[model samples]
Target: MTALSELNDDIVRSMSVGAVFSDFGGKVNSLDFHRTADLLVTSSDDDSVRFYDTTSAKLVKTTYHKKHGADRICFTHHPSSVVCSSKHNLDNSGEFLRYLSMYDNRCLRYFKGHKERVVSLSMSPVNDSFMSGSLDHSVRIWDLRVNACQGILHLRGRPTVAYDQQGLVFAVAMEGGAIKLFDSRSYDKGPFDTFLVGGDTAEVCDIKFSNDGRSMLLTTTNNNVYLLDAYNGEKKGGFSMDSSQNATIEATFTPDGQYVCSGSGDGNIHVWNINNEPTKVACLDSYIGVPTCLKWAPRRVMFAAASSVLTFWIPNDAKPGLESGGLNSEV
Candidate 1:
């Protein structure tokens, strides 16, 4: 893959698919990259959680939760552990929200406060605190050290929540293109700022802050991704994705915060450059199923996308002998 050289704007536009891991039998729901551990984790509808080594792009471990059926997954500060939201079968035998230790297959704790399916789950960057947004119309914050929720906020429509890179601030995106910012320290006092990009009435599917915390990405049910100014919620530019399905699309920011990448229902990975006007830089095609779930590597020149199969990507100008270890076939 592209060595860790100075990443310029053209590197992302020159990327190509490097590896394919088609081990999962069902669709992947979400994925997270560890901040400092160089690991990538995924939870899928197939009732499985898989971990991969970012250096080699090899499968490091795979575990299953047949009873709970894992959905959205995020890594806590501890590299060996993760917080997973369950798909939750009708019988209610599964843990809705759980702290799982992937090392020895242990369920450390169960968070049972949400009454409906949780749609968004995010871990704070600087602490054990995590947030979950559910169909029950609430955003609940919890600490890994405690089994109960530490704080809660009730709101209208589906909520998507995320913590800024510093974990000192958080943003909540809701119906009707409204974004509310709250101080992590005094969230109980409610939002200190709110922005209304009113026009699209679709429910928000996802929200993320850039690594530098200067911009935010908002994705909605109608397959639109908007880039916004983090300071005052001004719209920069975004993509009206050419997606054939209604799957939730996620856009991830490169470590340098200069580029954004997302997968489309058409089985292609789209890259966009953020400027006074965002532009689509590249569209790398994949033969695999719809790659709805995606993420950029924390500190590498690569990104991963998944549907029924998982694909790892890198720049086209890598060393000749370089090969991904897991599903070693390069696309």
Candidate 2:
């Protein structure tokens, strides 16, 4: 295993641009990058919302979530709206965020309706509409045009959601190995299709739509990942990680859709080539613990992974560490 010092030096030197804001002594649960201002918005167990400059790596602002700790945070595609959720107890004994809180100049407006804690939140890739998934087993769509709940579709179980590129279709992965699709135009009535995953019976942990919205990726608690056809809900291919001792937490497609990167419970990030035959491209072995989250930057040719600490990875243009070739050569 490489030492932390060596990993830090390699990342710092190879990183064309990055940031390290470690003021929060707690784990960062979620992170989102604002495209317009090039600001990074991060939420952690420390109950703080931090904004950092993506260019100069400077701390811009810090705001508390009104004494309530945040679990997940996301920015609407619009530059004006921000949404955040409170941490939820595993035993369901404590108060969680029942509504999505929109922030503007430190003033917050709650979009209340769900009876349970909000587990996942995402913004439409093509519009100002946003979607939220709750433990109440429902997905709700919110439109900023009216600041009200435009539609709600109940699922068989709690789900994680992602929107397609056109903002017309949304995918929700339920707890019982099922993924449902709903059209924003017809979301008020019902889902268009409910697709069942094969192989592992573990609950779906995360889901993401490909860059072109032609495919979707699903990660489960059983170290298995599946790529599905976005149109008809047919399985294109699937892969399982032998090194993943624990569940796969999240999987995401690179900007070009040639690779899929995932964070596992074994304190490592795995990259897979999805262009031809799917294979393990690289394994990022720098993280110290289970990576709670991962985010790919929009413009930069880099990505960030978060556990107890936030780590950035840029292409090793000189000498690549893994057998997958240098990041620059591949990306």
Candidate 3:
């Protein structure tokens, strides 16, 4: 394995396949690698959430939902149950995630409320509350402790949500290209701040906060990624992927906040350095399907990339010195 000290700012050596986890017949919709454990969870259109043991690359368990299929899946902060989104099985016309299902021994409990399909979901860092963003142009905070919806916040456009590392604050990237920040403690109140980026034409697809909570990253359908000052909502720096015809779906920060990984509809995963002098660190060329999600697993020394399949990459330990030109010195 590559030691943390040996890694330079701009290059990421692709690790060998430590183990292959699953060979799902259908496409993988979304996935999440656990922050503190060796486990990883994946959701697919096949209507299941499969768990894998990263250390052995073995399938530990497979939990199936009775609904049509899952659009997204994530583990709760408490580590006991999983939160998943699904659409109607027969007709895909009405996409509404009225229920947030928790899987335990193949049994499920639905947390229902929203009138539209849930597009994105996240759990609070400070409490057991979880939030879901939907095609209905609204976000609802759910308290798993009581299995009830706590508060609902409306947006001008469809929004994607993520919690900061501390869980005290959360960010929502609206489809109209604005980001709203809110405190988890004040759910019924309005947002504490709003950062406007593009006008009505640009759609914000994803938003993430840095590990230190000092910076925020925003990705738009226009192929632009912006880094903003977390506290002041000032633009720090941004890069455009205008050369490609594909839409950038999601962007995420590496654990150290040195690199940002973006998944695109053109079936490519691009990694970028965020230390002022931005550089494209690595591009994984194997995914033929659109790369929909990316997650960093810091402790396991692995990162999860989801396209049609869920793939895990570790640091290429055998070939340590290989260099990729995309890493910036400041990374």
Candidate 4:
């Protein structure tokens, strides 16, 4: 097996676009990587889902969701299944999250509850339990093993949700830069801790915890990304760039937690070298315009971004240690 994530300053700076897949007829809305697999998957406005083998930067399969229309998607704890939110409905299904089996093309289960669109969906890191935040002003928790929602929270404004590395707790980001933390086992009890992101007044776009559970990253529609202490909510630092209307630019952390990267309205990939004392941010041009959705591979030194096209980033090995990066086939 490949060595556990070789991400570093040299590898990140030497990185360039490795491969591009323009397979979507519409914009790629969401993408995710399997927890322990080299596989990456995306959901698109074209009403389809596509999976890629990150090892080769190659397409593995494509499935259509014409009836419901796929949007925010996430891989469940199982390898061959995923939970997807949909914008279109054939009957009175409401805005339901569909649990699908990729290999057999079967709807393993349908989780129903949200009255409005589900804006954020996250699969648990350790089990079948998952959670969703909806525009209807509520957050619901569900388990793949059960057909019904296990818990729900009614809150004001749009919300986004994420599970920490250990899955022992989860965080919810609200409209006023307020973040609430809850224990997964007893989430009905309410958030044990709440922290305000000092200056960002824009609605929270997405929230994520670093692999070490030490830091948190939050983004806003106003084109700002902030890194904070996951435990104390102390602001570490953040940066902003050109604005994109109504777009949530996601910021992701490398597996080693040394850096964070995000896409911007100006069609550039912004990399923040946070490990440095001064926190330097670099910009690299992107072929996929408005590359709003981006993610770093959970277990590899590679990263992927998308719009209507999906582009993979890998180290430009001519300087040194290129082949050892593991995603060389695309280069």
TM-scores, all candidates, are 0.94, 0.80, 0.84, 0.93
Instruction: Give one digit per residue, the lDDT tens place, for model 3 in 1-331.
Output: 5554455543364633333444676667778766676677888877777886665555677766656577777777544467777776524434333233333553344666666778788877667778889888889888766656778888877778989989988898885567888887885687899887744347776677887898888877767778888998888777665334432456777777777777665666777776776777677663445566677775545567765566666665533221322111111
Instruction: Tell me model 1's lDDT, rounded to 2 decimals.
Output: 0.83
lDDT of each: 0.83, 0.66, 0.68, 0.83
lDDT of 4 by residue, 134-183 (tens): 98889999989999899999887998999999999999998789999999
Candidate 4 residue spans exceeding 4 A from truth: 1-6, 276-278, 318-331
* Candidate 2 per-residue lDDT over residues 244-325, each given as its tens digit: 4432366677666767777766666777767666767567764446666777666555667776566556655523422233
lDDT of 1 by residue, 218-331 (tens): 888877888889999888886787666547677788877878887677767788777546777888786675677778887788888887788777777752223534335542
TM-score computed on alpha carbons, candidate 3: 0.84
Best-matching candidate per lDDT: 4
Greater-lDDT candidate between 2 and 4: 4
Question: What's the distance in Å from true for residue 82, model 2?
Answer: 1.3
lDDT score for residue 50 of model 1? 94
RMSD of each: 2.1, 7.3, 6.0, 2.7
* Best TM-score among the predictions, by candidate number: 1
